[model samples]
Target: MEKYTPLRTATLKPKSIYYPLHIRKLIKHKKKLFKEFKNSNFGLDEYIKVSKTIKHLINSYKSQKIKSIVSNTNRIYKYMKNISQKYSPIPCLENDNIFIFDDKTKCNLFASVFARSFSNLPTFDPPELTPCKFMHALDDIEFNLLDIDNILKNLPNNNCCAEDGISYTLLKACHSSITPFLSDIFRLSLDTGIIPQSRKVSYITPVFKKGDKNNAENYRPISITSTICRVLERIILNSLLIHLEENNIISQNQFGFLKKRSTTTQLIFTFSHWYKAVLESKNIDCAYIDLKHAFDSVPVRFLLYKLFNIGIRGKLLNWISSFLTDRTAKVKINNTFSNSFQIHSGVPKDPYWDPSYF
Candidate 1:
């Protein structure tokens, strides 16, 4: 029996079984007290007490959520690292005639290919989309301090951080110090006609697209930059969308990136439109246009001209043009790093900014 080292069997139990009933009742009672405090005309002392209690309760809830978020992000990061190990940088075409695997060679090759593809004409002419007349004055647009809070609130606490390693969690932790600085940057961009330097740098990831693995053309470039820049971009995007909405400028046929709109909405709308056409016995045809790397292929000079025509004039126009210029990126694959290269084209992909840019 001593040699056997007898062990008792353990039974698994649900988490709910472990929660003490007394603690549960106390929690319920506190919640009731919180509701009563909010509803009643209490004295200052009572109000302060209740407010502290409420804040304590909220903080406890948030702390639990933070734990879950950190755990999940850790898991996700590990999974990504594991998956990334399966695919390392390979020998890609140096030109149509040659192939090379060195990180520097690959980096330069990718940069040159995209730069050539997206190069603007020698002259930076105004874009074609500039409207004939002003629908709304740019200066008349108002920016509220509360909009800054809203932007911060919506930021995903766990997301791709830029070169600075400033995660949303870090930003949120230092929001008091960060907010004022960011606000000033936003105002200064609007005031001085120069966008911040952070907005111009992107960390490029060469995600594989459908094609020959050795061909650089097969990879689609995705940009991840500073969350701070993303926030500023969001502010600008919101302004742009408002201007477009006020002017009724967006086409009904287009359903990408607007509030409460998606590719699914467009698909449904198209099906209905075609179904009605079929029911009415009307002969019709439709064409689908899919430009490979459509977003990256657009020339910045031409896009600026389009925005100019659309009533984004003066400093606002200049800021947008400046935002698009002198942009750069560095590629990463496990530990092998590529040299920073100039990105001459492709609107940087921020979910908030890309659709509006087009």
Candidate 2:
């Protein structure tokens, strides 16, 4: 019996910055008064007075903290996250008339729903196009130690780690020791069209979208891949953009991923055209089209075909093909994780990869 040890458990309680020691002591005293009131009906009035005083102090402290945080631009988001750290466990999920209460089962249900959201219809063959004449072929791009170090330095320090359990903080801290090795690996991957298997596996968390929380379809999967994988992606993206810009492969009208162009610029350009049409006394006709799951539903084969037509061929294209294929992920709900499953289609929902693919 002495050799057996009990499993220790701890509840997560985020400390509030605005909470004062005096108020906490007062609340403890209030609990003591409440106990006396319940036993002998002696301290009811004192308990009420203490409760009101604690409430007033809390409001005052919260207001002061908000004012200080608002005065500084950098701390607003951090403060918001701290106050909004309340955890609400997901309720039981219903799938096919069966209710699932187990966390692992719930995670599996979400995985199945998210898997079906990918566009898995037959691939459409692209029409034949005239071969692009390039000044030079973009067969491969090499990375140096400086490039790796610079990318690591620019990475966000607050990002969560992926399934690989490698965090940005860890990479940035030990980059001097690992950059040379990473550079060699990147060069080899580009040259041989062989990417690491760990790079292709993502960790998914389901975030609530809208409607019934009990329904599995009401959540969207946010996929997180390895930190090292993203670094390689950045290197490839930079080279790809340079080739596209040099060859005039991408049109100016396509304003999503290019430099100095965004949704705001596109809106401004459209409104300017509308104002000119109004001045000319011309009739205006417009149609708005919004594609659902635009990022997740794109066929990988079709995307590869488009890239090939745009002069992204040879070893570079093969490397991209290898990166996109044979992807897998495990869905996590609370502390439970579902078994690993293969992802059939769609580019990763990461900020760096999604826009470039589009």
Give the top-scoring candidate (TM-score).
2
TM, every model: 0.66, 0.78
The 10-residue segment of model 1 with minimum total lDDT is 12-21
Per-residue lDDT of 225-247 in model 1, one digit per residue for the tens?
A: 87776777778778877887787
* Among all candidates shown, the one with the greatest lDDT: 2
Q: Cα lDDT of model 1 overall?
A: 0.69
- Evaluate all candidate structures by whole-model CA lDDT and list the values in order: 0.69, 0.83
